[model samples]
Target: MSPIELNKRQEEILQIVKNNGPITGEQIADRLSLTRATLRPDLAILTMAGFLDARPRVGYFYAGKKSAQALGDTMNNMKVKDFQSMPVVVRESVSVYDAICQMFLEDVGTLFVVDEQSLLVGVLSRKDLLRTSIGRQELNQIPVHIIMTRMPNITTCKKSESLIEVSRRLIEQQIDAVPVVAEEPAGLRVTGRITKTTITRAFLSLSESHEL
Candidate 1:
């Protein structure tokens, strides 16, 4: 069914049901000082929209914010693996100048910094390169490891983790992207990447699916 927005009276009816529910239609009409027939259409719309559930003889009850809660649960259950993109990786020893070039060439806002063994070591962003390049006597001589956010400080997520959790970390930590990694004997190994754009796309897809 197409989404229907509740009117003011409908909202008031919902609030009344929430405050005192399993309430009969007559009781609800009485609360508003209106006849039961006047409230019938509103109650029917709410019940059919899933905002309120009614029983044969028992009465009407609040459905616990079903629409919002259902959307939240759907987003929380979406896995990072389903939305992550291939990571753009550069060695930690790579020069800051070279890292900047790679970032531009890859057209990404952030780059995953890894060790020679392909283990995740750090993360470098455009801001880091710009800040370091401003006053640097020798840009090519500066290693990314010196300016990049190192391990333990870098926020990483696993493929199996929820996109909701990843999105939360991204917002809370104020980072452009997160490296999707797998635990190894030595350290976390980069597998993929999740960016703000990726989250936006995922949300759009979810919205379309729900609409369908």
Candidate 2:
């Protein structure tokens, strides 16, 4: 059913589950100022809608990984088979000048640096590009492979990894994006990207709810 079909009470219950699910029924009723009997129907409706799951001890939980349902699914369901878009990448041999141009043209803050085999080698950001360019380095000759962040140190997520984990890394590392990689018989392949903006937007949308 469409979101519009959800009544105010149902939405409120959803918000509660999203924020604090695995919460007990008594806790929900107390917070909403409704007795358990009064709240039961609303809870039942939401669960039936595929928006939540009622666990044995954990009263209820949002169906997706966290509070943000659609956003959570996108993060948890990272099998590359489920991602709708491919991530943008640049070759390690490219010039800093060229990388800067691409970053600006695409209006993105991060760029993935990869090898010919499509395995991710490093990550370059606008900061990295600008720092190198201020030294008046040759625009066409300086390869990004020199300054890019190399792996096994570079943070990455497999296609099966959760986006929430990726977002946490972004905040902790103060980076804008994480490369989504997939392991194949040939080796690891760069598959997609998870960005801070996507996670931020998903959470930011929650503020529109006034129920708290």
Task: List clashing residue pairs in candidate 1.
Answer: none
Off by over 4 Å in 2: 1-85, 205-212
TM-scores for all predictions: 0.66, 0.59
- The prediction achieving the highest lDDT against the true structure is 1
What TM-score would candidate 2 get against the native? 0.59
**lDDT by residue for model 2 over 1-212, one digit each (tens)?**
11324557777888888888789878998989998855654564455445778888768888852233353443354332223135778998888888999888888888988888888889997788888888866878888899898887788776555546666788898888787777777656888776776566434333322123
Give the winner by TM-score.
Answer: 1
In model 2, the number of clashes is 1
In model 2, state the lDDT of residue 86. 52
lDDT of each: 0.83, 0.69
